[model samples]
Target: MNLLKTSVFNCLFVCSLIFFLFFLLLFPKESFNAALNGLVLWFRMIIPALLPFAIISGIFIRFHIADYFSFLFKPIIGTIFDLSNEGSFCVLAGFLFGYPMGAKIANDLVVDRQLSKNEGEYLFLFCNQASPVFILNCVAINCFKNENLFLPIFIILLSTSITIGIVLRKFFYKSLKWDSKEKVLKSLNDNTSPFEILDSCVMNGVDTILKLGAYIILFSIIVKMVEIILKDFYYLKTLIIGFLEMTNGISYISSLNTSFQIHFLFVLFCVSFGGISCIFQTASMVKNSHFSMIKYLIVKIMTAFISILYGILYLKFIY
Candidate 1:
């Protein structure tokens, strides 16, 4: 059965790659322009926003500040998610910074042996999120043209993430057990020099950002091809693009002359989903680790559904 599954997957992957390459060859100019735009977006927005957080997160992990943070938040995180102090740090980072940061931090903890594979996999499910900054500024204020929606949207996303974390913890409680508590405690006692740690953090942060950028560019090309193919079906095209890359999807939806409620709900759903581009970036982050992309994808879809339902309830109550 395993061999059959692997063979089927390989065939699908190869066929998909071939189809993608054929589009690239057929529309060389479009593909090139899309790739360039993706690169520009990365340099102008993604790097400035994410690099500092990534570096600080690395420094925190290297100097064991994350361990201290984990310790401080352990009671709440432990009770809710059944994570150790280190895993708690991953959750905090995800809540604050968002996206592949959660996956990156989870991978880091797993690499350092602070979290067992099960714990890492569990954390990976809900820790990867869209940052509050993006939600408030881009989606709420800019896209919806309503700053009032910020609190509701933020609350919805946060509640959904926490709820999913708790649910996953309950479902996997037995399998998600931690390793030695002493080892987790000992991680807080790192003896590395500050300078060395800083250097390592900077390099690691750059490497991670670059890898993230590549995925963004590749997916941007794919999204562009998809857009070209589905130009007539604007609504469906918007959704498909959003499924591939979230920012583009949100921007497309916001430009439409739709009702405010419909626009808001779609944006909320896309932001909650975080797009296939983010999933691939996250998958890359945990590629060598024990984290399960399938599990993460399932939890993300659930969160997206929850976000839409919450948005509907909020709208009914508010207006």
Candidate 2:
């Protein structure tokens, strides 16, 4: 079955590449602009938002600051999530930073042997969320045209993530505390200078952000291609675009002349799913790690439904 899946994936991947190449040859200007726009978005939004956090998160883990800080929430995350010192820290970082950061941190922790493979997957299942920045700025203000929607959107996303986390923890981790049981923690570098740690963090951060930028650029082109290729089945095209890349999908959905509730639910779904682009980004971060993309998608699908449920309740009663 795995072999069959792999074969099918390879065929689809090759076909997609061929189509992309052909389309690029046909519309060089559009592809170039798409790449350029992706780069600009990365520079303007991703870098400014991510670089500092990456560096600081690296330091936090390396110096074991996250352990101390995460311990503070032992009463809550500790007891409820039943995580270790490292996993607890991830809870905060995952929710706050969003996206691949959660996956990135989990990979780092697992590499350092501070967290076991199962423990990493436990966090990976639920911690990785859509960026609050993207939700507020892109979805709420730009797409929905209402900054006030931020609070409710936030509530739905947050509740869904936490709910999924708890459920997965029960199903996967059970009641035990997840930590470095078999995987011993990496030895602390006593001789390493603070400057050395900072330098390492900076380099890793730059590398990660660059990789993320490339994915963004690639997906931006794919979204553009979808727009150009499928003229028929307008709604089908919109769903495909949204499933592939979220920001563009939400933009397309919002531009249509629809009632507010329909628009709101669709927009809510996009943010909740975090797009195929975000999934690839997260997968990239944990490529060699124990985290499973299949499992991640299951979590995302579950969250999307949960979020829609919340959206309906909000629209029906709260909004």
TM-score versus the correct structure, for each prediction: 0.91, 0.94
TM-score of 1: 0.91
Which 10-residue span in candidate 1 carries the lowest summed lDDT? 180-189
Candidate with the greatest TM-score versus the true structure: 2
What is candidate 2's lDDT per residue for 1-319, written digit by digit as tens?
9999999999999998898899899999999999898999899999999988888898898877888988778778877788888999998899889777998999888877777778888888888887788789998999888999988998889888888988888776784444334656666666888888889888989989999999999998888788787867678889999888888899899887889999898888888888999999998889768578898898898888889998999999988
Each candidate's clash count: 0, 0
Q: lDDT per residue, candidate 1, 127-178, as tens digits? A: 8899988888888877888888888889989998998888877776456655
Q: Which stretches of candidate 2 lie over 4 Å from their true place?
A: 1-5, 175-183
User: How does model 2 score by TM-score?
Assistant: 0.94
lDDT at 238, model 2: 92
Off by over 4 Å in 1: 70-72, 174-177, 181-193
Worst 10 residues of 2 by lDDT: 175-184
